[model samples]
Target: MTETVTLTVRGMSCGHCVRAVTEAIRAEDPAAEVAVDLAAGTVRAATALPRARVAALVAEEGYAVQD
Candidate 1:
């Protein structure tokens, strides 16, 4: 079953940040669906990967993921 993970990411100020975050998540699950809310600083992703893994990928992009 697919799981949906929503993470609060810090330091995302523009569209580039969104793309970066999306790419980071896709790095782990290429078929995952990622949605970015710049104003809310949240990244909602649908994937089978563990939440911890998703958070780690977001952090890899120099973004803080609020668990």
Candidate 2:
């Protein structure tokens, strides 16, 4: 089953950041739907991956992701 992961992310202040995070998550799940709210510093994704794994993917992109 697919699950939506909503995480509080920090240090994403531009379009580049958004793309980077989105790409990172999508890399893990090609069909994942990713939405980044720069103003709110949050990322929401529709994916089958576990929440911790999703957070780790964002972290791998050098962004701070809250658990």
Candidate 3:
């Protein structure tokens, strides 16, 4: 089943960061819907992947995903 995973991500300061996060998640699930709010420092993604996996993907892009 698919789920929406919302993460509080830090270190996203520009479009590149947003794109990195969005692409990172999309690379995992091409159909995943990703929205990044740089101003709010948050990422909201609709994906089938587990929350931990999503967070890990974000972290891999050099961002901090808060619990």
Candidate that scores best on TM-score: 3
Which runs in model 2 stand beyond 4 Å of their true positions?
none
Residues 1-67, model 1: lDDT tens digits: 6899999989999989999989988887899999999999899999988999999988989999886
List of clashing residue pairs for candidate 1:
none
Q: Quick one: ranking by TM-score, best first?
A: 3, 2, 1
Return the TM-score for each candidate structure: 0.93, 0.94, 0.96
The candidate scoring highest on lDDT is: 3
For 29-52, candidate 2 gives per-residue lDDT tens digits of: 999999999999999999999999
lDDT of all predictions, in order shown?
Answer: 0.91, 0.92, 0.94
Candidate numbers, best lDDT first, in rank order: 3, 2, 1
Q: Is candidate 1 or candidate 3 better by TM-score?
A: 3
Total residue pair clashes for candidate 1: 0
Instruction: For candidate 3, write residues 1-67 as lDDT tens digits.
Output: 7899999988999999989999999998999999999999999998999999999999999999898
Give the Å error, residue 1, model 1. Answer: 2.8
> lDDT: which is higher, 2 or 3?
3
